[model samples]
Target: MTFVITRPCCNDASCVSVCPVNCIHPTPEEPEFRTAEMLYIDPETCIDCGACVDACPVGAIFPDDELAEEDEPYLRLNADYYLDHEVDAGEPKPVRTPKLPEGEVHVAVVGAGPAAFYATEELVRHPSVHVDMFDRLPTPYGLVRAGVAPDHSATKSVERTFSSTARKKNFQYCLGVTVGEDITHDELTERYHAVVYASGASTDKRLGVDGESLPGSVAATDFVAWYNGHPDHADDAFDFSSARAVIVGNGNVALDVARILLTDPDDLASTDIAEHALDALRSSAVREVVILGRRSIADGAYTNSEFLSMRLVDGVDVVIDADDLELGDELARQVSEGSVDSTIGSKVRLAREYADHGAQGADKRFVFRYLTAPTRILGEDRVTGVRVVRNTFDADAGRIVPTEETSDIATGLVIRSIGYRGVAVDGLPFDDAAGVVPNDAGRVVGDDGVHVPGHYVAGWLKRGASGGIGTNRFCGQETASSLIADIIAGSLPAPTGSRDDVAGLLASRGVEPIDSTGWAAIDKAERDAGRASGRPRRKIVTVDGLRAAAGG
Candidate 1:
């Protein structure tokens, strides 16, 4: 049977490289690859060799007949892509490792996230290359361990690839070492042939509306971190005393927040969700989540996969108002006629179906409201409500504008999931307005517009916060290529000190960096604890706890 690409597909393109017949659409070489929600396999061209099933890092591919009841829709979804777009079954391209500088090329990568792992994966392919990866946290896998919703365990499986990379003899972990605080950027450049920064966007975008800084209103980033057991937010106390929570954006993250609020706490108990967050969820008074969008349903930012998943939650009713889909006569007609991209058409269609189904008196409600923008958050002490204004899509300017009508939504909590903003790396020149390090093709550029030698960046920090977990593969590869090219040209400076010297410096500073063995001990401790509780793993959610688990 032909394989179906299902939800949680990270678009890492590993499957694309292994497909013997090149059945996957939107290969990394294609323009649509950047925007594709998930890669689709062309059923007509399939040899059904199961190469993609093995290559898929996230385990998103499965035989059509083997799909779970909830994922059966993907069988049709994969075929639908080929209906609209033609497939070129060209000779499949194999994954290749680029040749690097012959001698030992030492590199230091900051941040232990997907980008950092992917960059390290590329760098360690050479026999003589050694990488020292650093992270501020005691544990690794920054967002994969901390940002992804707990329910998405398949997405977390990409950690297996990262684990393999970490096992390479040429790679070493320097966990719990904060670059700026423990070691300066200048020191990193002085100690390694090249320094790659893969630290992801750490902060969230704000509503900038009045009362946004109030206690009840919080960034979705912090909430995700809190729930996912990021040590930084493990002790966070969320006021779920309110029956209704309003999320002020309609991206996948906003949906994730809504799902977490509405999902049965028992359903999450087996997952890696933090114990404190789980207890809070079990006692949460939240019953309804209202997700607001500034534009029409056709222009919503969330992907079709996420939208579909919302409907399948066990006890939650997905609500959509018919009025929200009534864009002007012309625009509505375009959506109905499937004149827009297939993904957008599917979202509008799904929304209309939900509107027709109406609310089913479920225990929890997920409400979607379009053409609305928050003018201000309401309350004196904490968020009691939000003052929102009606909006209309101005076709000419291609933007949404506020209308005269206004309404107040009474909600005790407000979550802004607008987007993530990259925090400035300690010594890197940053564009404060854009929330990204100023770089040209992964090379860090200074305010004077000159490339800073031996310094590079990848992932969200390099190109704002966009794309999913797998997108970092291409990003990391690009940055690694730039570093390798510089090394070949002798543009990078020679290292003044050895790895032993850096270790001595850390020891002098009273910083005991966790190596791969130490992290493995922490991993085993967490898994052992999780086994007793029948969970994936009970995450060690504090620096001291993690260190103790690692036998530090």
Candidate 2:
């Protein structure tokens, strides 16, 4: 391979559009892209034109001759994706445009993240269907702006597509508008033909042990938001006075947190990380991050591409304990039997290589601990350490079982990155068990399995929190199908009011809706501020700051 795509590929898929050969698998149009940790350039078909090298925003692509020794494995990782599938013979058929309603229609989409944006983009395909988007924050593009790691600038580029969707004629944005607080479900239902909810999962999974709320313990959700400048967590502080930190989950979120912690402060200076987080990192004492996996190496949830990417960051040395990498007979048999796919098997194989060689050490160390579970977080006012019990892989049972052995790791900070869950919407029937709106397909259904007329959902609210950006396309399409079916069947409720009336209602409540033009001012101000600092963009992290910047 003369060229390769490596660890810094943040799934933006920009390179796919640039490549003349279209060798990248799961080009965001394919289903696998949603679940993939990162994109890979298929070694079998790449023409070595090196168009990807210039297109990669994070500098993730490089000719094989210039590949970092730590990232040499990606040459195989990229090739591995095509092992089970045939290479594309030619360009894929252009994506099919969604069939939208034929006449003037008004829809209210509550949220302005990727899911809502995707749904909105589809709704506006019909020139006559106008969409009004409402989000709680003055700024939109929920996670893209405030949840993605600052270093992953490529992924943020997807927002430009959303901006185009927003600018579509007749589309309106009502930022700083809170659902249920300022306007109730009944109010939206009365004014619009259909109401769609795309508010993403907002809460983090809990460790559910003692001292979880200690000053030193935090959620990866807040940590990410704090660094990426989420308004709700802009003032939050993390304890970095200790030399060692413990992250309780081994998923991609944990990987992202680890990368941010170990990346050199100077490297973050030109990124969009909030000033507060950058300042805290500059004065930090943390040198080691221990990511604890509750399952065996074969069961690790993070993608192999992410595992390889972490090694390429300049300051961190990542090590996997030698004993943990051993496939332990059963998993090895599965790999040999072809019961286990190569994408997953690669993690165990390459992890063993890191365990065998990466321990020489560097300025910072990132270590992985498999088959370990934290039984309790030990301490009172602050997290002093965690008490963990050894877990044995019960291959037949397909679960991790507790053993008599125990271990204690002394650490000042513990960050939980288990998962994310959605909160209940006031009027919608929510399945607390799944943290999702009770739905059949895309139509919001009640607990008794009866459809809630005109109510629909997309993205994390429709499904659980999982998958990446591409996943939302599936959801947006499904919800659009359901809503369009209802509209065609004449089953949708007739709107009792007009756009003027809805605007009048907001005026009566003294709520000023920020339109697309106002949002442009905020975007411009943030970029102008970034220009002064020589960064990509400087985020406004307060609701007041956002309002002022938007010329409110």
Q: How high is each candidate's TM-score?
A: 0.97, 0.91
Screening candidate 1 with a backbone cut-off below 3 angstroms (N, C-alpha, C), the clashing residue pairs are: none
Pairing residues by index, what is the TM-score of model 2? 0.91
Candidate 1 residue lDDT tens string, 2-47: 8899998988888988888889988877778767788898888888
The whole-model C-alpha lDDT of candidate 1 against the native structure comes to: 0.89
Off by over 4 Å in 1: 328-330
lDDT string, candidate 2, 479-509, tens digits? 8778777877778887887756776787789
- Candidate number of the best TM-score: 1
Stretch of 10 with least lDDT, candidate 1: 93-102
